[model samples]
Structures are given as structure tokens and as C-alpha cells.
Target: MRCRIPETTLREALAAGATYAAIARAHGDDPAAVRARCVALDLSRSRTQGRIPPEPVLRVALAMDGVSVARLARAWGCHPDALSRAARRLGLPTDPVGRAALRGGR
Candidate 1:
């Protein structure tokens, strides 16, 4: 049987960086069911072990000039590698990259 989770609840959990398995355990749903529902709804979140830093947090940190990923990672109390992994999942630049490079312009 498919598990049903409210969109709002799922989105909130996702925005909070909860993994599918974690959300499943918390809501008494099977992990596969949560994953299936997410796929059906076209909802996905990038995360590492434990709770990942929210997308907004990563975006703001990436947008800040003169801030290194390592520095931000330190401030966020997570390893730099974790942050990098999540950024890669979200297709955002984990390092400083020129706009040209990001857009394949150069």
C-alpha cells in the first residue's frame, strides 16, 4: 500500500533538510513510499547525513562574496565536504566560479 503524506508536511520536512528515510520514520511511512510520492510530485531535496543545511542557507552562503566554503562550513557546524555534496546535488556552485564557466560561455 502507498503511504500518504500531506504536501505541506512533506515540503516542510524537506525544507528543513530531512531525508526521505528520516521523514518516513518520523511520520510512520515507509521510506520507499515517501520517495515514490516525492518523485510523483517532482519534489527533491539535497541532503547529507543528519539534517542538511537548508537550501536558502546554502544559497545565501554561496551568494556572499569573499566567503569561502570552508569558512561557511565552519560557521554552520558542518564539514566542508558535506556542504559541497549538498551544493552539487542542487546544481549550485560549491566553489567560486565565473558566470561564464557556469553558463559554458567561455
Candidate 2:
């Protein structure tokens, strides 16, 4: 099952550099639940054996309806280009639409 964060707020918080655990705390959800949504969104690259990383956090932010990669990267204390490269390195689809396409196997 998917996690319980409101898709909109998850995006907002993520863009603000909130970790999955912090986002979950903000929304009164289990951190694992937050991680699940990140996974479902393909925002998470690594398997869920450990903590969710900043890369996935950026992914989720970029996947939000109006969030931008540059904005999220700045919020996360990194250069936009670096975050962009990290997303690519983690095998995350850069475009939100492309990520969505992945989820539905389109």
C-alpha cells in the first residue's frame, strides 16, 4: 500500500529540504509510510533498508505540481546542477511526467 502524505504537501515539504522522516512528522505519519510514497513515486532509488536520502527528497519535490528543481536544490543546500546529476545517477527520471509514466508502465 502507498503511504499517507498528501501528495501536495509532500511536494511542498520536500522542496523545503524536509527529510521523509521530517515530512512524516509534519503530517503525523510514520516515516516508513512517507518512504513508501517516495518509493511509489520513484523518488526513492535505493532499497528501503536504511534512511531515505536527500536525492529522493529532491525527486519528490521536483515531482510536485509546481515545484522546480532549481528551487529544491537551493533549499537542500546544493547547486541545481549537482542535484540534477544526483537524480540521474540514482536512476531517477528527471521529469515528473516521465516518472509518472514509469509508475503506470506507460
Badly placed stretches (over 4 Å) of model 2 are 1-55, 99-106
Please give the lDDT score for candidate 2. Answer: 0.67
**What tens digits encode model 2's per-residue C-alpha lDDT throughout 1-106?**
3577767777677667678888877777888889888777766533222323466575566566666766666666666777677788877776878767645555
Model 1: per-residue lDDT, tens digit, 1-106?
5869998888898888788999999989999999889878878653333445788777766777777877877777677889888888987786557422444533
Query: What pairs collide in candidate 2?
Result: none
Best by lDDT: 1
How high a TM-score does candidate 2 get? Answer: 0.40
Model 1 stretches with alpha carbons more than 4 Å out: 46-106
Model 2 worst lDDT window (10 residues): 44-53
Estimate TM-scores for all models.
Answer: 0.44, 0.40
